[model samples]
Target: MISSEDHARLSQAIREAEDLTTGEIVVVVSEQASSYRSFPVLWALLAALVVPWPLIAITTLGPARIFLIQLLVALFLSIFLSFPSRRHALVPRFIKRARARETARREFLGRGLTRTRERTGVLIYVALAEHHAEIMADTGIADRVGPEVWRGIVDELTDRIREGRLTDGLVAAVRRTGAILAEHAPPRFDDVDELPNKVFVL
Candidate 1:
């Protein structure tokens, strides 16, 4: 969902953020955690299955007409669900959040954020389809920064995203997190660039 210009700016922000701290920060964006791909077909089938019942109970429609009506209902609903926006809306809120968090955690591990020398890697993750964001922190940093601190950053970033300021929100979150890391884990003489600074997109 990010544009080319935004990607460059976000990468630059990451570069700057890592300059003053040994802690590693990674950002990842995903179109969606899971497709929930079968939902549309299920909805269409359900629409077809349910139509016959109402037709049989409430109306004196003949079998042929009822079947035709059921077929039409199924076709219409299937076509409606073919739209990505409509299909996404059918996914439950809890499922969306859970999937986003799961995906973020997977990325944290997949990108080697958990293997940093000081256990100080943090991930700023966004799932655009669900409009959800998560901040995943490793033990070294979370031990110093309370849960409330991380919550505040997630909340603020979510608000900015809702306002359509994703790039700005990410940069601000990176800077804010960088300041906190600099305070708790300032660069050492032997500090290494343990991870890349690019914005990971999936």
Candidate 2:
């Protein structure tokens, strides 16, 4: 969902952020956390099932005709609800947040954020489809920082995403995270780049 220009800018932001702290910051932006294909199917099925009941109650149509109408309703709904916005609407907010969090956690581990020296790695993850953002801090930083700090960053990032300022939001989040890390885990003399300072767009 990010352009090449935005990618370059995000990478630059990461590099600058890493300059002041030993902490490894990785940013991941994903189009979505989950496909949620089942949502369209579930909605289509429910609408079809309900449609047949009303027809059965009010119409003198034969059972076969009623069944055919139900099938057609299901087909139409499946096509209409297959749209991304429609499908997303069918999913509960809690489910979207949970999936986004899970995706963030997976990215944090899969990207080796936990394997950094001194365990001072932080992951800034954004899921565009779910309109969610999260910051994951390893023990080295988390022990020194409170959850409220991360929450505040997430809130700002989410606002930016909602305003269609994703790149701007990410850049700000990276800077803020770097400042926090610099305070808690300033660069070491032997500090080396332990992770790729680039935005992973999934």
Candidate 3:
């Protein structure tokens, strides 16, 4: 959902952030963490079950007709809920957060953040559709910084995303993360850039 210009801005932010500390920062923005496909199906099934009851009680329709109507309702509602917006609505907030958090962890590992020379890698992940964000730090940095500090960064990024300023939020987050790492994990004279300074939009 970010434009090329915004991508450039994020890349610049990453580069600048990494300039301050030895920590390698990776930014990933995803359309969604999980498809949540089953939520729509479950909703459709529930609707169909409740709908047939009303038809059976109010109308003298035959069992065959009521069954057909139930099938039709289920089919229609399932298709309707398949839309991204509708499907997202059918999922609970906790489920969304859990999926997003899991996705962030997977991305952290998949991106080789753990393999950095000093184990000082950080992943700032944002899932737009889920309205969630997470900051994951590798062992080196995690040993020095607390989870509450990262939680504050995630909270700010989420608020900016809610305000429709995704790029701005990321830039701010990167800068803040850099400041923290500068304090806890200052760059070494022989430090080298070990990760790409680009935003991965999935």
Model 2, global lDDT: 0.92
Off by over 4 Å in 3: none
lDDT of 3 by residue, 66-176 (tens): 999999999999999999899998899999999999999999999989999989999999998888889999999999999999999989988888898999999999999
> Residue by residue across 54-136, what tens digits does model 1's lDDT show?
77889899999998998898888888897889899888899889989889989989999989999999999999998888898
Off by over 4 Å in 1: 58-72
* Per-candidate count of clashing residue pairs (backbone under 3 Å): 0, 0, 0
Q: Could you tell me which residue pairs clash in candidate 3? A: none
TM-score of each model, in listed order: 0.89, 0.94, 0.94
| Model 3 poorest 10 in a row by lDDT | 50-59
lDDT of 2 by residue, 55-89 (tens): 77888899899889889989999889999988899
Output the lDDT of residue 151, model 1. 82
Q: How much does candidate 1 score in TM-score? A: 0.89
